[model samples]
Target: MRVLKFGGTSVANAERFLRVADILESNARQGQVATVLSAPAKITNHLVAMIEKTIGGQDALPNISDAERIFAELLQGLAEAQPGFPLVQLKAFVEQEFAQIKHVLHGISLLGQCPDSINAALICRGEKLSIAIMAGLLEARGHHVTVIDPVEKLLAVGHYLESTVDIAESTRRIAASKIPSDPYDPDGGFTAGNEKGELVVLGRNGSDYSAAVLAACLRADCCEIWTDVDGVYTCDPRQVPDARLLKSMSYQEAMELSYFGAKVLHPRTISPIAQFQIPCLIKNTGNPQAPGTLIGASTDEDGLPVKGISNLNNMAMFSVSGPGMKGMVGMAARVFAAMSRNGISVVLITQSSSEYSISFCVPQGDCLRARRALEEEFYLELKEELLEPLSIQERLAVISVVGDGMRTLRGISAKFFAALARANINIVAIAQGSSERSISVVVDNDDATTGVRVVHQMLFNTDQVIELFLIGVGGVGGALLEQVKRQQEWLKKKHIDLRVCGIANSKALLTNVHGLNLENWQAELNEAKEPFNLGASDPSGERVSPAEPGDCRLYLEPGGCRSVRGLPARRLPCGHTEQKGQHLVDGLLSPAASGGEQIASQVPVRYQRGGGAAGYRKPAEPAERGRRTATFLRHSLRFAVLYFR
Candidate 1:
């Protein structure tokens, strides 16, 4: 059995829906196949709008007859696309479904309360209409004709539309149910067993869940998910210049990738199917024949193929802990429970027993809440005695390469770091899971996208990833940042990862460890004032920022030291110098800042009389006499002088 799920985009409109029918025909010919589908893209939103409007006392109510007419019109369009399906016949069936929905909506509008059941009932109509239309087209094409509402036979939703599966019984009943009716004419009816039924309204994106559930229910050899993209990309191609498609990934990798940001599959939808060891094929709806990504238990034969690239940016990663929490199992539970209650999602989590810390990342939007929760709960612990105050940093991003092949490759980590090093980006946080299938890094949010692409380059890039880091952010630092931001578009176009991780001043610092906004970093720096002492750690050394001779002295290093750099010792014009007992007149210049120049000086060279290697003679009468003075280098090190009258 083959179960196919067509997302909204795959069956977005009549044209796309017709294409969906054709793909199903091809599958049906091979063997028995069933399909799960989502609402046509705009219909659900439109339905929601109508519901909202009616609730708001707007005069847009489509009474029974009017709704029936609209549904008929929608169906007529579906039938027109497929040859020989009488447009009139399809329209009648659509009228009936819409009539049922209208009666429900009218009841809802009258009551001014759209209950969860009413909402699901209305929303599910789009899929119902599409399937009815598609099924008719399939029958006209001479395939086995049957249509089933997940709500009627396969699904039994609860009070609020939550889905739960009692599969053993649900399957037994589907196996025993009567010949399913041609869904095109629902009045024709079909028999469904009593115990084999439970409401399984797939959640939003639940179509994928529905498809997998059906595949597992049928004990099918495989399931296919058809969607818009070719397959999962290692990174979002739009954001990363070098994002690559991951042709195949293990069940675990697929889950991990989706959890990060790979959108091809749902995060939890894969586990149930994987439990059955069912292989899932991800095929593009646009190119139906192309073998897309596949998920299975078996490892890849080509050495772990790049599974996919994924990243989460603008994140704040924190590791909060104290010795009190060390080796304490419930500490994580307490912290995570608190986060969960506040509706905060921690995307990645890891812990160190020795360090007694648990670090995870939350979306920037929730960083404040997460920070507040931890600080409030662990405040006294951190300030009064322990180290559990929480070490939180925002403006961060996480990029990870997930593949099971990591287990076999001894130096995979090496290559991962090398690629970013070539690009000159830094790794702020690094974690390796116990499974070792993937390694993730927390970097400046600005470089998040670059970090993913650079790793992609190392793993699959034709050209290696080179990175640069820019430190100084003042006059020259300002100019340098502007230049980087302006040239960044061109640089990315050229595949140069010019990363500006952290920009510092004397008080606060702003970083894009992922890479700065090449377009507006100057203003960003002007508003920032973080003091920093530079560190010389090179992760990817390609260069986020190139050092200007002047930039090196100012921007290259983090903070300016009070003592000036490269200053020459000076004596007073009055021949005054520090005596041993007197305070020394030390002459040193402060380190170079945004702008500067050397002081004025015009010391003359003079020679002293020399004879048979004897010491140079002093000025004629007195060194301070009112006469001309001549000086010469005696030992070629210092000048000796004589006064001439």
Candidate 2:
């Protein structure tokens, strides 16, 4: 027996739904197949909106109407597609489902209370509608389909929204149930299931979880996830055009990727099936013939050192540090316990070897709560100054590189860092499981996509794409583009693809990451409609950004530190140096009277005598007088001078 799961996108509209019917029938023809179905695309979101509107005492008429219209339209379209498909029965089912939904919404509006249990019941309607439609479609096609409701057949134990499964109980129930055996009967897949007692829902992407649960219990040959995409690509294809599809990956690799932002598979979908050593395949419903990725027990076959790169954005990293906490036992326990008690889940964590500080990442939504929880838990330490107040950095992204080969491969970690460095992507923090299944790094949101592309190049030896955003398209920017276009071939030979992804002047913006035509970039910019703004986002929505921290600020400040804070003050002239330190100032301050006047007007400059070969310091006037200063270098100052007089 095989358990197959189709996501919302796979059953998105009437055509897609009908297509799914065909795939199900075809697969069932090969052997016995049990199916799991998700609600139609965006239906869950609509349900949540309705619930919110009801609880807020706002008009839920639009939501209720839209929900009804959505299903009505699908039914109408399905009827048109299949003339004799029992539209009457389907219509009755849809009307009854919406009637129940409207009743629930009205009750919530009157009570002004939308609890998790009620919300779960409301959201489950989407799946119910979808499964009903699918079953009707299959039956109309003259195929015997057995529809199974997980709420009745599958057993789960937990809260209303995010319930945990009772594996033993679920297995027993599934074992006793009569799954479709006849080649004609493709077990009409059902939405969700719960234990006999109360109705409990499996949280996010519950359908995928449902499929895995059934697959594990039945000990199926493989659990297949059918979605819109062909399979899990090396990177997000929408971002990286050349992103290759992954043919096969280990269960651990798939889990790591899914948790770290590989969207093809649900994070919880793997553990259940993996427990029984059942392989999971991520296939594309749009193209069933495609060899979708096969995720299995062994990681030995895949040759690549890194199987895939995954990233999570809009995350904040929280660091709680205290010198007093060093060598303290149970400190981590207290810290994590507070988070747990507050219902804040940490995605990644790292700590100083000395135990002086602990840092972890949580979703941006939980940032404030996580901070408050830590502060309240360690109130005594904070009040006594033993521990520093929580340091929260927002707009950070976590990029993870996953592979089973990393365990046996040497320098995999080093190669990853080196690749990011080459791309000028700064890493804020890092964490790696002892298992070496993956290496995760935190970066500025702006650099997340570039960071992924950079690491992708290093591991896969693919063409490195440099996404450039050029502001000035006149002299410098225009000239750079010309050179880039000219050297495209030369760069390709070096395994680098330099593409002018964006170009803008003061008036308009014209850009494309798929490599804008440099030869006509100027013409394109002229015909561009939108005004160029500092906050211009990538048209492709691929450029990861909070924007790499330092962007062009004070556009007139030539060659100085690019940070807005590093803008030159009116008091100083020529060029602004980085505050951290200064280097040898060459040909800036000279003994020449004209040079002296310039130097006199500038900030105190550091200099090193040419012959002395000594370090830079305050200039010596007696020997330096009447003689031209050969070379001058500034250090730890914000200003520097380079002049020849």
Candidate 3:
């Protein structure tokens, strides 16, 4: 069996979902198949935010109701957009899921009780809702789908969305699960469909697990993951004009790529699928005819150990150091135990075997928690450890390159060093594991765009280029876009190519990686005629597109507005528009603004309204003579003037 997994983006909406169905149908023609699903695009992040809000003291009960509304609308919108789909029936099923979660959240909020376990349950709902809808849609398409939930086979914690697979037990359980052929029957086949329906997500890249878990149980030949981007590029194509894709990669290589922030595949996915030696395909929805990047166990390459470049942004660096009990054996355990107790998960970590000091990473959001945990538990070690209890940094970015070829190759780092040097970028921190499939580094986020582009430039050769589907077109976002558009010609002329992939308003979305024509953006926007969704409340609430130091190119123009909904159209940072005085006059001159009122009703001016007239100035001597003549004429005309008056 070939297992195909479509990510949140691949099945985000009705159209993409339909596209996914088509992909499945095509794949089925080759062999027996199954597909794993992720939550709709961006849904997880929003759900995460809601959890954060609850932690910050917002009543999640009402928010759950609000989320349900959003879900229902998006689902209906997608259904209506896709043709030849039985979405009417599908809509009710999805709505029911929305109601279930909303009901639970409402109950929790009313109780004013927010606990880690409760929050994880709430967070996992998005994926549950997504998978349920997907399985239903697949069934509607006449495909046999056995939907599974982690709660059934995978042992998990109530406080965390992730569950560690009891490899042998879960595998045996999955293999034994059965599916009911009848569409209406609730009983289902060789999956968790019949067990606990509540979802228990795997860590960070849990959806990958849903696929791997199923794949491992079935011993499938391959697992195919569908996403928005084409197979892995040499780098982020936007920065480097020529980031190309390697046709195939070994499992070790894929794992390294993923670990270093490539995001091509999930790390845990490797342990399950790799152990079974099942190959995986990274495919893109836009181009089915194209052969995607194949990741398998076989590793045989004579050249080019490095395959692709990846990056992670918005990272925080946290370090704890002290000289307390240098000979202590439990020092490390105590520090970590405290963080775990506080429910703060540490990410990247490094330590000296000497046990004199320790440093690690946590998501920026959890920094405060990590700090508090350390201060509370290691109060004595605080003085012994060092002068400072905590050190932190925000605005850092991480970049990595993965390749099995690197193991046998020397001078790999030379190329990277030279590329970064040529670009005048600095590397903040470096970490590499013994596997040698990947090289990782930390850098300032400010250098992220430039840094990634430079690596891409040094790596790949491609005619097809990067595309960005920008959502918020506010100040900085708007400025950067305009700058990109304006400089697009220059970039293309210099052999660099990029396009605006898509633009979404609050309610509408328009995209074509070939790029929507810049000159007629407004006309195109009006023609697309999609519903627009923009409001006072966006996640950033900054709702304003960022305009910062690098955004000078966008703002040279005196007036411009982001294309986001509710924003008034304005000029780009670099462009020139009519001055305010003239612009104001033009507005007042407008028939609509003027209410068809005549200009004579408005104000006085030297010139008459539409009156044919000429203006002239006499010379100085002639003007004096004319004044004397006017005075004499007035005196002589006194009698006639009096009579006229």
Q: Pick the candidate with the highest lDDT.
A: 2
Q: Over all chains combined, what TM-score does candidate 3 have?
A: 0.63
Q: What's the candidate order when arranged by decreasing lDDT? A: 2, 1, 3
Q: What ranking of all candidate models by TM-score puts the best one first?
A: 2, 3, 1
Q: How well is each residue in 197-244 modelled by candidate 1, as lDDT tens digits?
A: 433244456677767767777787888888998776666766554566
lDDT of 3 at 239: 50
lDDT tens digits, residues 1-645, model 3? 777777777766667766877777777777777666676776666677666665566755555556666567666765676444556666777677666666665665566665645666666666666666666666666767655555675543332455565567666766676643322211111122213454445665577766776678768888777777788667665554456766787887777667656666777677788888888878888777778887787744324567878877777776666566377678779878998898886656667677665666667678778778878887866656443557777778777877777888888777776556544457766767787877777777766655665555455432223343444444444444566566677656644454664565444556553466766664565577554332232222334232232221110000011111111123323333223223322322233232321110000011111111111111122133123322222111000000000
Instruction: Give per-model TM-scores.
Output: 0.62, 0.77, 0.63
Better of 1 and 2 by TM-score: 2
Which ranges in model 3 have alpha carbons more than 4 Å from their true place?
Answer: 42-89, 115-150, 153-159, 178-199, 238-241, 300-303, 319-345, 350-358, 384-391, 459-645
* Tens digits of lDDT, candidate 2, 37-58: 8888888888889889889888
Indicate the residue-level lDDT of 375 in model 2.
Answer: 83
Total backbone collisions, model 1 = 52
Write the number of the candidate with greater lDDT, choosing between 1 and 2. Answer: 2
lDDT (CA) per prediction = 0.58, 0.68, 0.57
The ten-residue window of minimal lDDT in model 3 covers 636-645
List the lowest-lDDT window of 10 residues for candidate 1. Answer: 630-639
